[model samples]
Target: MRKTTFLLPIIVIVVAGLMSALFIVDEREKALVLQFGRVVAVKEDPGLAFKIPLIQEVVRYDDRILSRDVEPLEVTPLDDRRLVVDAFARFRIADVTQFRQAVGVGGVATAENRLDSILRAETREVLGSVTSKDILSSDRAALMLRIRNSAIFEARGLGLEIIDVRLKATDLPKQNLEATFERMRAEREREATDERARGHEAAQRVRALADRTVVELVSEAQREAEIIRGEADALRNNIFAEAFGKDPEFFEFYRSLTSYQRALKGSNSSMVMNPDSEFFNYLRSPSGGRAVTPPAPLPQAQVDAAEGAALEAAEADAAAGTAASEAQEEAETDVNNYEVDQVEDAEDGVQN
Candidate 1:
């Protein structure tokens, strides 16, 4: 029982020692074996690893890519504008030995703190040389690249390979937003005012051109109309002269008759003129004036026939005149009898 107890305790102690000596390094981890607080071995590959129990220790670091989210940092750009910047960095340990030497027992946390400082310092240095507008411009990729390069250079001593550094966001402080918005609003208003002025000027120019076009068209139309009227008057005068040349007496007589017809057309037509006015010369004598030439004499047979016709017409006219006289006398007699009847009725009424 004593031997069994001693063997049992020895086996337990040996098993515990073995457990303490054996270590594991995963594919995602890098391990450092330290003895007396001094690094003795680095295990980068995955699988089982051995360490001196009680004399050595294993410190594992993630070998995979890691990210560091920096706190919001306030920076002032060359434009003297204050902005809050949020950034992140992607990095990995490039030299495990150098990493251990640089960041002793603090491990990943120490490395991260150092990386954060480097990122902040580099970011401020790069950003401080440029205006905020450039940071916000399409050149943002170049700016980020510059910041990354600068951070990488500074972090070289920290045994870190800075894969990339990025600005998550850049924002102006609340105190400056109102001023920025007011300035933007004023600039837009000025542009709008210029546009409106240009529009008004263009409108005025169009109106002037339209007015000029209208005046030109009206003047041209009036000139054409006057030319047409002059031609028409000339034609009328030529036609009148030709007619007069053919037969002066007949033309004058016809013209006088046309005038008389026009003057006497309306029932209320009246004119104040001398009895012997030239307008009535044709009426006074059908041949017109002193220059009137009588018509050619007719043949004897025609004259005889005309005289017989005239005699029959005169007899017909005498008979018609006599009938008209008798009708008038009868109308007068009827009117006298009606008046007498009216007078008799009045006398009888008075007597009654």
Candidate 2:
């Protein structure tokens, strides 16, 4: 009965000891055995792991990818502008032995802290080298690549592989954002005002040129009109001279009748000339001869008719004057020829 009792306690203690030495390494974890606070063995594969129950302990580490979102860091740019940035990093323990030696059982937290410091330092270095505009534009990719390279260099001694380092958000500090927006607004307004001034100046130049063109066109039209009017007046005077030169006596008699019609139409005075006057000669005889007497008075309507008939008679008398002038010229020509013949006869008699 004492042997049974001792064996039963021994078996129970042996089972409890084995249970304490044996540990489960899940598919997502790796185990490291530390003997007397020194790393003696590392189990990278997932399965059961064994260790000395009282003298050794097993430290498990995650073998999967780990994500760590860092706290937002405030950094000053090269231009002295303050910005807050949030970032995240993905990493994994590529060398479990080295990780265990370096950080022990702290798993990803130690690597994450070291990585956060490196990321913050390198991010500020790269972002400080450029302006805020470059960070917000196409250069952001290049900036990220530089940051990744810097972080890789920094994390080389930590026995952790930095898979990726990404920036979550980059923003100006609240205190400075309003001032930046105001400056941008002022720049845009200045550009707009300059554009409007250029447009107004261009329009003014165009209007001035158009007004000058209108004046030139009007002056050109007036010059052409004057030239045409002067030509017309010259043509009219030439026609009048040509028609009057054909029969000067008849033209002068018709002009005299026109003058008498104009003068007698509005006259209130009576003439007191002698009956033998040359003016009365045409009224009495109606031909080129001495005047005899004035014609008898007639009714008013007949007087007007008689005046028209007298004008007609005056035109006939002018035609007779032309005939008389031609006859007088012929007589003068005969007298001259007779005088020349008499001179020739005297010369012939002297020769005889």
Candidate 3:
């Protein structure tokens, strides 16, 4: 019983010791065997792994693709433009032995820190040679490719294989953003001003064209009107000439009548002129300017009545003159007879 107890305890201890010495390596992990802080072996395959009990330690790392996010960093490009960049990377531990050697007991933390530093350095080197515009442009993919290559090259020392190096954001620094926005705003304003100026120029051109067209139209219309007026005046002149040629006297009479109408147009019109003036030729003779013989005598009955009235008026005048002479002779005789009678009376008296 004592032996069995001692053996059982010893076996239990042995099994425990063996269990402690042996380790499991997962396919998803990369393990390194370290003795006295030195990496002695690496296990990358999934299986049972062995280590010296109490003398060696096993450190495991995730072999799967890992991600590291770099903090936002300020970078000045060759153009002296500053930008804030946030980036991340995908990587894997490609060599556990090298990882163990490079980053002793710090394990994944140390490896990741060193890898992050290399990635950040590569990012700065590649990105600093270009302008911020290129970093933010479609060409960013090519720039990232360069950064990844550089990171991969440098990451070999840290046992890291870079899958990708990508920028999350490449933006103007906060202090520069306002200035950029202002510049952009000013540029837009200038563009708008230019557009308005162009519009005004175009409008002026249109107005000028319209005014020119209007002038041309008016000139053409005036020309047409003048043509029509001239044609009408020619026709009128021709008609006047034909009528005058046919009967000059009649034409003169008609012209005089039209002149009279115009001269006596209004109620307030008054004209003083010699009655025998040539202007009265039409009135003096119906043949206008031509002289004519006297008109034929009136009917015999009308002539006899006029002569009879004249004889009666002459006889009445003669009777009035004869009566006046008789009165005068009678008055003289009375006076002379009175004187003779008085003288005879005087002589008689003297003789007595």
The numbered model that scores best in lDDT is 1
Question: Candidate 1's residue-wise lDDT over 241-334, tens digit each?
Answer: 6546667666666677788888987884888889888887877875555677753343466455445555555555555555555555555555
- In terms of lDDT, the poorest run of 10 residues in model 3 is 343-352
Task: Give a tens-digit lDDT track for model 3, residues 119-150.
Answer: 77888888899987788787678998998988
Better of 2 and 3 by TM-score: 3
Give the Cα-based TM-score of candidate 2 against the true structure.
Answer: 0.57
Rank the models by TM-score, top first.
3, 1, 2
**What is the per-residue lDDT of model 2 for residues 59-146, given as tens digits with 9 covering 90 to 100?**
7778888888888988776667788988888888777777766766566777677778888888889888887777766557777888
Give the lDDT ranking, best first: 1, 3, 2
Where does model 3 exceed 4 Å of error? 1-8, 133-137, 140-142, 152-154, 245-250, 265-352
lDDT for every model? 0.77, 0.70, 0.75
Measured against the true structure, the TM-scores of the candidates, in listed sequence, are 0.61, 0.57, 0.66
Poorly placed runs, candidate 2 (over 4 Å): 1-20, 35-38, 53-56, 95-107, 129-137, 140-146, 153-157, 232-352
Model 1 worst lDDT run, 10 consecutive residues: 343-352
In candidate 1, which residue pairs get closer than 3 Å at backbone N, Cα or C atoms, i.e. clash? none
